[model samples]
Target: MSRGSLFQRAPIPEAKFQKTEDVTKERDADGKKRINQYVVGELLGQGTFGRVKLCHDTVTGNRYAMKVFRKQQLMRKKDFQNEGPGRGMSVTTALSKVYNEIEMMESYSCHPRCVNLVEVLEHQDSQKIYVVMTLGEVGSLLTYDECEGTYTAPVPGEWIPASSQSTQCSSRSSTSRGRSLAIPEPIAKCFIKDALEGIAHLHEHGIVHRDIKPDNFFITTQGRVLLGDFTVASKVDEHGRVRGTEGTYSFMPPECCTPTDESQEYSGHDGRAADMWALGVTVWVVLFGSLPFQKANLKELFESIAECQYRIPPDAPVSPEGLHFIQAVLVKDATNRLTAKDALAHPWVSTADFSQLPAYIEAALKVKEERAKKAAEDASVSGSSSFTGILRP
Candidate 1:
């Protein structure tokens, strides 16, 4: 079929589609790209950058996650400095920088726990880039905090973290058991470990997730984790970049909490340290079922994280070890914070007895399953039921 008219991801009849093993990546006249016509399927998901669809390799009959990036949507967001809500983004913002995210995601496709970056293709005449990737059902591990709606795969540089972060996905608000938002603990742990494995793989390969939060994680039906969205990813350079803050306000590390020396480029602190900070926040969310610095507004949140003065509430259930783990990574001083390697060795996580973790996970799964079954029954009995939270960062 010609590569001209497909738009959003819509469901296709199974009979009209074919799947294949050999991928179809090609270049057309003028060398632009003709990346269309692979038999799109059901809408897997949608995010700020683009949408993911379950597609079939018309020739091989194999399944793949087809990610489509809208050049214009990103372009509009590029000039974010002007938007009332988009303020706080660094000055000198460039629309083209997003390509870096695409490249980052594309390069690390083969790492096991990391989501595979398969092939990147462009549309016939538009600026859209069609990225073919492997689907991570229980995508990266955004704790229960980021798990409001669904796991939406990000574009290249917009790396989705293993911690389920739902910064903008309001639908993922948490449950504290109030018939409104009861967040159980075991499921939270499953999200944490799965995310750790994905980040562990990335750190092993010298790639720092830079941004790690609840929204970035994606979960599968079986609860596997996949670290995703590598858009802001940058190599750790001894010398920092001269400018730009490429991160969500809540997700930015302690250093980015406030610029120290703009002339020297604040990015030097990039790498495992930043990732750890994100993890610290994610862990807080998992256990508390909300942002550690949940404030009335951004200014308050910034001040709280900046002063490192947030409270853990005397009545909270956070473990001492868990508290230690959070402190280890959240240290404002880069030198004092826990590296990814050090984090893996920390007593809180290591000595927690993972042997019991699986049982906890199984129990949580059962809870979710029961919830789903009852919802189905409720739907059948009277078109009405209840709800829950999300995943992002």
Candidate 2:
């Protein structure tokens, strides 16, 4: 695809939402109700800053996920910003993330697959900020995968983490429950194809989604995949540079995962290429239900990732096209890896058969069963580890 074609801007559509400038909380008077148009419902989820809730528009009855961030927390985060790059957060950084999310989402709102902001609300008295956006009824893709199938793989006592411990995936630490279960190759291909378009849209606008993972790709009740979460996203500068080692550990690119020492200067990474690397990891997890670098030892895992030492098991039912696509994207050298635009044009994405998706699902189920059996057998052995042999190129 041509750069000009990829960079084309799509217009944001008109929605019945109150503008940020017009939002204000009305103080409650004696036995009187507030004049707010949005009716806050159930608590949806919680984050470091605040919590999100289900909300409804009184006039149109449109549903939205309203994320409210506490001003005190945001300010506290701001006070800690001067410590170092990843040490602390400042109010300026907080506000920049909020505005950046709004701007980036609004820029691609016209695209049906991209998650868009519905409205933004601020309450000075309560010292909070609310972001209203499209609600993903199915929650995160991780939750969806976990709930979709039965856990036939018996849990080993040794694999169970201590109460204070958890498994790390890239930068994010998730409980064992958050571990992946592979989806069908055809379905993965479709989801990836859609996600690639959204990523391409972001790259075209000079924005990089620093954190790209299965959880971030939310699916609506209508079954459309929407790329959400922009708190860590950054816009590329004039030199196409973005600095920082922020993102989930499992989904981060090899370059971003390079450990820094006092003797070496921390060189920033290529934001666009990093996104592509995460995209490759996300696709691998979705299709195989496992990460390539699944070592219990973090040091070895980083070394494996740095060397592009991951295997797509031969017995797994991945098509040649699908395997080729993954190998192409998962290259160690960012300069040689496929970009979002290039990936979209790959035969694995463009020419895959949508009708054979059911067969693909069946194959995935078999692989899941085999994996579970192998896990059970390995657990019965003396001091056996779950690590497998890396695929040699």
Top TM-score prediction, candidate number:
2
Model 2 RMSD in angstroms = 12.2
For candidate 1, write residues 109-199 as lDDT tens digits. 4654555655566545656667666665433343332455222211111122213233212233233112211223334444566667677
lDDT, model 1, position 333: 75
User: Model 2: what TM-score?
Assistant: 0.70
Clashes of 2: 9
Over the stretch 97-199, how does candidate 2's per-residue lDDT look in tens digits? 6666677665555455566778777644656677888776545544323354321211111222342122222233333333333554445666687788889
* Clashes per candidate (backbone, < 3 Å): 70, 9
When superposed on Cα atoms, how far off is each prediction in RMSD?
Answer: 13.1, 12.2
Determine which window of 10 residues in candidate 1 has minimal summed lDDT: 1-10
lDDT of model 2 at position 332: 86
